[model samples]
Target: MRTVRFSAVAAVTAAALTAVTACTAKSDAEDGTAIQVTAADSTCETSTTTVPAGHVTLKIENKGSKATEVEIVFPDDRIVAEKENIGPGTKYRLTAEVKAGEYEIACRPGMKGHGVRQKLTVTGGTTVKRDPKLDKAVADYRAYVQEQADETLPRVETFAKAIKDGDLEAAKKAYAISRLGWERTEPVAESFGDIDPKVDVRADGLEPGQKWTGWHRLEKALWADKKIGAEEKTLADRLVTDLKDWQKRVGTAEITPTSMANGAKELLDEVATGKVTGEEDRYAHTDLVDFKGNVEGAQKAYELLKPVAAKNDPALAQELDRQFAALDKLLDTYRSDKTSYDFVSYDKVGKDDRKELSDAVNALAEPLSKLAAAVVK
Candidate 1:
């Protein structure tokens, strides 16, 4: 058996680690005080339990044999800061604007199991007065996510029907189109337990005793094996059903400005780590299409938050605009005549072009990570 190294899977795992913090590590601690946090196989050690309530930078290092991730969760279970995909000896920095309150620090080693956690207490800082504008932005973003879900539910039905009909040719065409809606709303889909897996789980990560199902399973059957069986039809039906249920539930889901900003950064991280590697659409060679959808979704979140972010921190807002535009322009060159992106198989993508896309995404993500902090300032 061949040892398959799915770099894209590893990247997704890494991106999940720091879903809360997206900014690049600062060269100088000019804006915030730096605190050291170390992760090992059994322990998550912080330099201090208490921090001033304001801009706080967590400089997290993995001193473990396996990949590790650290996250700071609020009393309400909201993530305020995190960094993931820290290799055996790697380090990352995440800066967050914090309120004076109790928080929790958690560390997951090898990216499995419930993480070791410790209490984190913030002091000597006042929470900012609540802003109605920021609240409205959060509400609007949720509505947008709900709207995407509403649009995607029907498309999923179409894709599933093609598979159920055993029309491999039609299924192949519908597969990519169906993914656009899901990709645009992936961050929210992920919040619905089991829905994301049922609709989009890749081949790499299957829970123990869990049979692999969903779109990727069907993708392999259709594209790799060139056969569609009863099993494929069943999986397709479940996917459409799951998506329908997911869309109904997402309308009233709780979402915050912090989550919106993090979602945007998360989507860019998806592009940087997975789509760039072409490992995401390995079977279909449709990674470019997925990449465009992820970027479009991220861009929407940023645009929705632009008003409040600009009011609080004009510099951060302007930087995001420039980076978003730069990334979009580069992505545009890959468009197919009939679609937003030209379909280039992962194996056929040039290294230079891959690097270009990867670099552009990272440039956007760094500034994007700072938006939540800026808005709360």
Candidate 2:
């Protein structure tokens, strides 16, 4: 294709053409002009919607294997008309008219994040631009949702399966993996911070034997530990529902009335899931013990690895730095409040209180060194 040189009006026209891809797509030949926009590096034209609140229908054709999301955003990149096309070569129709205002067209793959952004100018329609902050909330929600679906749910299922199989070793491994996955998603749980994990997730009636530690799995007889009775099933079912809801609602669609509603629904999902989740205090009192152990192990390993870190190796210092940093951050995130601010009382000490601080900081960084050594070839 030739690089089309443009005069002033032509330049504006190309920019406008780029903008035309902004809305949901539909043919309005009988009623008005229909501009077809194929997305980036793909022959799929985006969906376009007519404006000024008329009877309009925007048809989006996503000619790809993966699901695709298209949006008509405001000049400020707020989605105006949005549609999601699922699976390979799926077509979605958005039967809504764009109100008057300035907007742009943006499309992205379903699993992937946002995609190509094109500016769209809807003539004679009300353009309801979005508040930029809403976009951030949607993004944050999406990240959390991905973590829940990709990591949290799978981990939960693994743990449940392990317990169901009555395999102690598998249960143990699942427990640890579940912790990592849960930690990754725990921040979003803050939004639904009221869940009392003990009551919500207890394995009362389930027989001992193996390690049925997580909720939703039974050991031996039918919930013999029916401390919660049938209500437990209700909670478990709610958790599963919440997980699905989170998977669906946490998309980066426009903050339109519908998207706004979806945002609320996502929050609700968090609540439902939170209600059923047995919250293991990541920084539980026992975890402090583990953290301390990991730190010391890291430090000792690093100290040992230092000998292996050839003196001539330029990267040695940096690797040491990186390992220490990760350990420190982990410690900082989970360290007890007592140790975070106060100094450990030493027996024989001088005015060198700095030594105590060094001890504190080192305590956190010790784990990384040990971890590094264990993995070192």
Candidate 3:
């Protein structure tokens, strides 16, 4: 649908920057029970902005000409439920079970700016205890993220040392290997303040007057600028130190099923938005490597929640499996006899091929986005 996705840094940083599945009370409503939210070019109007706290559903209809999205934002700005790329004349049903509290409904028409908003007061629903099975699933994912961090941080130390030692070849080889860990756990990583920007900021994401640093900076020095001097070495060292700090924080971080599902979608969004455009690993032309890592990570996260998703919506889960397999098939075409992908420069991809990749990603993202709400039920 060509959904306009603002960068996560700009769109969601103020919020806790995590997507959480709401523990809404288990209840079924009549077919017409959902509130009708109409998203137009300049306004977001709803049938009713007030509702009982548990198990609220919004039948969001995008009436605007442009692609639009709807978000149910918690008091802390965390997104409890969201539907992206609701193209004109299309409608999507977003359900969430939240505590009795005030929330905001943010509608992004044309996928730009802070979306038009309305106060959504959720009141008078009984509080439901957190589910033990969901908690167990969350803990397992956290452990997986921690394991990835443990493995990745040490390799990054080596990558930084290689750069410091003026071993550009060694550093270049290590670059792809090290990123494997980071991409898998990026959703959880984004929660740790400062670490995400320090470790993975793209040049465009930098604030005015901010010098570029981290992996991309080193990538430019190694491949494009062809100079790995003191400045680049310093950046590499700082990245390693930050990664170590990030590893320490992983154990203490909280992961919810919703966050994991959305994280998977977020990684693919990276592929659809920047990586495919060659904006991410510009110098190295290694966007394919990152793309693969994102897909793997997303796949793993979804797999963890597969049981719950199946229980709630078996058809949706089956469709997701089919879509993932399709995307995986497309990605597999890029591999070569060498351990690494035999990817040409992004500029070299044929238009038809590019469209195919985009289509596959969008296909996966569509069904995948529905998983967050399904599992929480």
For TM-score, the strongest prediction is 1
lDDT of 1: 0.71
Model 3: lDDT of residue 129: 51
Clashing pairs in 3: 24-97
Q: 107-176, model 2: which lDDT tens digit per residue?
A: 5544223355554556664433433443444455455446544665676566555545555446444434
- Worst-scoring 10-residue span by lDDT in model 2: 1-10
Error of 1 at 87 (Å): 3.8
Stretches off by above 4 angstroms in model 3 are 1-132, 337-348
Give the TM-score (vs. native) of candidate 1.
0.78
Supply candidate 2's per-residue lDDT for 348.
Answer: 23
Q: What is the overall TM-score of model 2 with all chains considered together? A: 0.28
2 against 3, candidate with superior TM-score: 3
lDDT of each: 0.71, 0.38, 0.73
Cα shift from native, residue 189, model 3 (Å): 1.9
User: Residue by residue across 26-137, what tens digits does model 1's lDDT show?
Assistant: 3236546566778887777776676666666777888889887677776444446555566899887666666788887777776544465667777775743557877677
Q: Clash pairs of candidate 1?
A: 334-342, 336-342
Regarding TM-score, does 1 or 2 come out ahead?
1
